[model samples]
Target: MRNFIFILTKEIRSYFYSPVAFVVITIFSVLIGYYFYNIFAAFSTISFQAQTDPMVASQYGVLNVTEFVIRPFFGVVSIVMLIMLPMLTMRSFAEEKKTGTIELLLTYPVKDLELVLGKFAGCMGIFAIMLSLSVPCLLLVAFFGDPEWGVIVTGYGGLFLMGGAFISLGLFMSSLTENQIIAAVLSFASLMVLYMVGSSSGFVGEKMGQFLEYVSILSHFETFARGVLDTSDITYYLLFAVFFLFLSMHSLESKRWRA
Candidate 1:
C-alpha cells in the first residue's frame, strides 16, 4: 500500500510538472465551453421561436433543460475525452522507456500490478482535473434552467467510466512502445474502433449486430447517458478497465524478464 502511494504520488507529480497536461486541459476547456455556448444559443433561438408560433410552442412544449443542454454537454465531453485521454496517457510508460528510466523503475521493490495501478490512478486524477474544468458550463445551464440534477450526475459518472477505460487502453498502448507518438496514435485508433463499431451493427445480421453493439464502448456509455444505470453497463466498464490494466502489468512484467 505504501509503495502504491509512492508510485501514485510520483506519477501525479510527473503529470503536473509536465506541460502536456496543462496544454490538453486548456484545449479541452476551450472546446467544451464553445460547444456548450453553441448548444445554449441554439436552444435560446428555438425557445424564442416557440414563444411566437403555436406550432413551434407545441413542438417544444416545456423545454427540458436536461435533455437540451446537459445530455449534449455530457456527450460532447465524452467525445472530447476520446481525443484528450490519449494525449494524457501516451506517456505513462513510454516516457520512462524513452528516458531509459524503466530500468531504474524496475529496480525498485514495487510490484508490476502496483505500478500499473499507481499510474492508472494518476492518469485518472489528471482526467478528473480536466473534466472538472467544464463544471462552469454545467453551472451556467443550471443557473438559467431547471435541469435534472440526478441525470446530470449519472451522465458524469458515465463519462468518468469511459475516460478510465480509455486511459487503461492508453496505458497498455504506452507500455508497448517507447515512442509517445506511436502510443498515442495506437490508442486513438483502438478507441475509435471501440467507439464506432457499434454503429455498424445495423448493417449486419441480427445476432451479430447485437453482439457488436454489446461490445461497443459507446453502447454502454449511451445507456448511462440516458440515466439508465444497468448493471451490465457498469460491469462492462469495470471489466474493460481491469482487462487493460492487467495487460499493462503483463507487459511490464515481460519487459522485466527480458531485462
Candidate 2:
C-alpha cells in the first residue's frame, strides 16, 4: 500500500510535466462546457416555439433540462479524454523500453505486481487530474440555474468510472508495444469497440439486441445522466473498471516474462 501510494504520487507529478496533457484537458473542458452553456441557454429561452406547443418544457420537472440536455453535453468530454488517454499511457511501458528504464526499475526490489499497479495508478492519477479540471464547469451549471446537485454528482461519478475503464484499456494497450503510436492505435481501436458495444445490436436478433443494450457501458450511463441513482448502473461501471484493470495487470504480467 505504501509503495503503491508513493508510485501514484510520483506518476501524477510526472504527468504534470507533459504539456500535451494540459492542453488536451483544457481544450476538452472548455469545449464541452461552452456547448452545455449554449444548450441550456437555448433550452431555457421562452421563444415562440415554447409559447405555442413547447419543444422542451418543464425545465424543473421530470426529464429536467439540466439532466437530459446539459449533463449529456458534458458527457461528450469523456469521449475526448478517451482519445487522449492512450497517447499518455502509451508512454507507460513503451518509453521505459525505449530508454531502458524498465530494465533498471526491474533490477531493483520492486515486485512485478507493484510495478504493474504503479504504472496503472500513474495513468489513472493523470486522468484524475484531467477530470478534476472540469469541475468548475459543473460549478457554473449550478450557479446559472437550479441544477440538481445530486444528479450532477451522480453524472460526474459515471464519468469517473467511464474514465477509469478507458484508462485501464489504454494501459493494457501501451504494454503491447514499444512504439507509442501503435499503443495509441490499439487503445483507440479497443475503446471504439467499447463505445459501440451498446449500439452493435443492429446485427443481432431482437432478443439479443436488448441484451446487448443492457450490457453496454453507455446504456448504463443514461440513468445517471437522468439523475436516477440506480444500483444496477453503479454496479455495471464498477465491474467495467475492474474487468479492464485486471486485463491491464495481466498484460503487464505477460510482458514481464518476455522482458
Which candidate has the top score in lDDT? Answer: 1
The regions of model 2 sitting more than 4 angstroms off are 46-63, 255-259
Each candidate's lDDT (Cα)? 0.90, 0.72
Across residues 14-128, which tens digit of lDDT does each residue of candidate 1 receive?
A: 8879888889899999999999999999998998898888899898788877888778888889889999999999999999999999989899888998999999999999899
Given candidate 2, what's the lDDT at residue 116?
68
Report the number of backbone clashes for model 1.
0
Candidate 2 lDDT, 1-259, residue by residue in tens: 7777777777777667866567666776677667766776666664324555444334333435575455666567666766777777887877777788877777777666677678777877767777787777667666756677777777788777777777777777777787888988998887777678788887898898878887765667778777788897788777776776677667656755765
TM-score of 1: 0.97
| Model 1 residue 40 distance off true place after TM-score fit, in angstroms | 1.0
